[model samples]
Target: MAWGAAAILFCVWTLPFAELTGTSVTCTFSEDCVLPCTFKASSDEVIHWNRNNFIVHSYYHDADDLEKQDKHFEGRTSLFKDQIKHGNASLLLQNCNIQDSGQYSCHPSTTQGAQESWVDMKVHAPIRSVNIEKIDEEVICSSQGIFPAPNVSWTTDPPTQSDMLNNSTQTTQDPNGLYSVQSKVSFMGNVSDYAYICSVTSADGMQKWKTSMRQQGGNQLPSWIIVVIVVIGIGIGIGIGIWIGIWIWKKHQTEKNRDGVGNPGDQVPSGAFIAPGHDHVPPDEFGAEYELLTLWVTQKLTMPGTSQDPSAIREFRGPLEPSLRPDTIVSVTGLSQQTSLVQVGKSPC
Candidate 1:
């Protein structure tokens, strides 16, 4: 460590340069970042950026040259030429990554004198949402697309004495070289006594992050859906009740007919007969047959006895029950012209 420190100090003191302005520039992972290096320069000067003696970027002859640039930084580093005329040779690092965090030296030299400066870069990862879900009835806690392969583990709080848990875990790299981590702890009993937390620590150990599954709220169906379901159920129930009432009413009517009972002003039971007369009845219960018979009988009783011949006042007789009114009105469809010649009558008992 002492040797390493001495070597760095010697390099800094020996360089024909000044310290880079400011402490450090911070950047997010998978983003672009700029390393500040401002100084007056001629378009003819050569500019070189190096990290640990490896060329990160080189500009000479008024253009960039990657012949000596490190393979690790291939196509990932460039210098600002538009501002270079204003003495700005700031380096733009493309797709900033965890491995890119380090000290970089920017040196521009002319025949008169060479000046150099060093800049520090710090790369960070934005915290990702940890997912909590139930798969096949087992609890799962997972995080994805994180940089530097974070450390993932389960914990509980209000702080349990033993912070460790038995779990299944896997870590995989994404296409962009970040990490995806999944971890699940077996849980069968006593959920109320404990709440789970998914904790992540970046490989560099600078970040400690945790997410609580319980704090994210419930996954049950929404309240509006429940309310809609209840309303639909009520509508179905009402429909069923109306259908039952109609069925019962029809069944009662069928049973009434079978037992030889009938609606008001109905004809007598099958073995009985009727004598026509006006019978008072409740309007809603009157049958069509009884209505015709009553009308015919009232007309006959009111007609003048112009045909005084004894045979003209004819009467036909039959056993009659008090409950039935005569209902024998049928159409003799083609006989209208002989109406007076036809003598219709009732027989005496």
Candidate 2:
């Protein structure tokens, strides 16, 4: 297949023309393209337009002559007879397709001799649409109905470190000699978020398409993450509340002590108080010491006690009641090593 295509291209390269005209004229798909030429011939002179010996349009003696025209160009080729006197022998080819791209020549003959001028025609149909698909780690890219043997290539984005890529392409010519191309590239299984680019280029210019096959499951937040966040937030709120409560309690205690509600060396009916000089203590530490002292007194009262026994010197009898006694003083620790203690009396066990 390669050799056959090469031979066809060789023949095209060897095609002859009288002289090169201004420049190659470009035409869009299914549109008209002008193969321009100029001459000083009269309307009475004969003009012949052709592409590599294929009849495109013919005129003789001031009128069109299609008796020898090719069937493919039967009604789609025309010449402007009104402009012939102005030295314009341009030919208009309509509904241009891929096969219409080639070298074109206009031969205008006068009574003296035949003269020719030529221009190349480039008919283009860029790839207007492209589709890409991925199936089981294989990616396929395709574009259809392009013209003039377009160039096709495949590329990967976030380029793979692997030097070798599993890439392949297949191009088939249509009935109109246009092209349909498909490209495939493979990769290791189970890869995601990979992008691919496919491009086609020709004398008409270039066209490209990019695609990826990554799927996003959904937009909602995950249940586990949301649960964790709520739990953490609750824990923080509880911690803050406890801290605030302790601070409020300590502040109240300090205020009461300042007013001499129950200062150390001062006695109260329900309890004896320590000196209120530990103003430098933090609220949290002060609250902890106060709670510890309260718990110690409660525990001692639950146990049996015998006040008459020398070994139980601090013990008191059942039916104990709160009483302010000099020996019942509790030491509190602070700037003065003033420890906090609670007096205890026991019930019958």
RMSD of each: 12.4, 17.1
Q: Kindly list the per-residue Cα lDDT of model 1 for residues 1-349, writing each as its tens digit.
A: 9999999999988766544444488789988999988666654767899999999999886799999889999998888778776778889999988889899888876543566888888787655677777554345878777877788877775555443455788999866667788888754343444566778787878777787654233334456787899999999999999999999998877444323322345332321222235342223333222222221111122225633344433222222334422222221111111111112234333
Q: Write the per-residue lDDT of candidate 2 for residues 226-341, one digit (tens) a residue.
A: 78999999999999999999999988876444332232432223333232323232445444433222211211211246433454323211112343333243433332223455
Candidate 2 error regions (>4 Å): 1-23, 41-43, 110-114, 162-164, 203-205, 215-349
TM-score of each: 0.52, 0.49
Q: Which model scores highest in TM-score?
A: 1
Worst 10 residues of 1 by lDDT: 332-341
Worst 10 residues of 2 by lDDT: 294-303
